[model samples]
Target: RHQGFFRLDPHVDPISDGGNVFILGFCSPTVMSLTPVGGAMGSLMNQRAVSTKSWAAKEDIDVLMEPRTLCHLHGDARQLLNHGIRMGVDAAQLKKQGVNVPDNASLYDWWGGMTSPVQRSPMRLSVVLAFADVDEIF
Candidate 1:
């Protein structure tokens, strides 16, 4: 069912496995929670790239970056172009019902990608980004 969702290529460099992080937060369904913890986590992950001395001996740096790079290969390269198309169409449909998204705010990419299907493809991440606003929420 996940077919045609993503592609994997290994020629890319800076691959790492690091880890697959998933976060789920519970809310009252009325109030939106925008926390700094997310940003702090991102910063820590980025630091892993520079902290070559630590975690280096435990894991290969190249292997650590794999999941991130592969995720990007899945579709991030085309995100900046395709994201708005999907968002705009939905927004237009909503506007017809008097629900219009803010002009300064728009849907943004959070994360979406397919894992490498090939058995030999190295572990890596394709890409990662953070987005804010109502468009992204809905």
Candidate 2:
């Protein structure tokens, strides 16, 4: 079991284990209990490329996954993309901070029964394991 929020800054994980990281979300009926209410909702992925000596996000590759899902990143996807959790900000809050939000923008209009602002979740329990792929090691 893990405690507190999981707001990670986007970057390539150290991968010192020479293995991929696996994430599982345990959020369910209490999903709304996420810190910031709707903030920290899901996970985000962005394409990354080398810019001289540093890596930077390339445009047009943004993606977000809803809460309590399973995902694995391997090979190029693991090494060449920056990943992190999404931070949710209420339109009201944004307005209070002087950012413009259309008064009519209610936002949560998913077609089906699912609704979440992309890759986001406030907290989760993570178990890390390492194993060198035999093919990669051989």
TM-score of each: 0.15, 0.47
Residues 36-69, model 1: lDDT tens digits: 1112222233332212122122221121122223
lDDT of 2 by residue, 12-111 (tens): 5576656575555564111211111122222332211111111122221333333455556667656666554322334453455465555543322111
Instruction: In model 2, state the lDDT of residue 89.
Output: 38
**Candidate closest to the true structure, highest lDDT:** 2
Model 2 scores a TM of 0.47
For candidate 2, give the lDDT of residue 123.
45
lDDT of 2 at 53: 10
- Residue-pair clashes per candidate, as listed? 26, 9
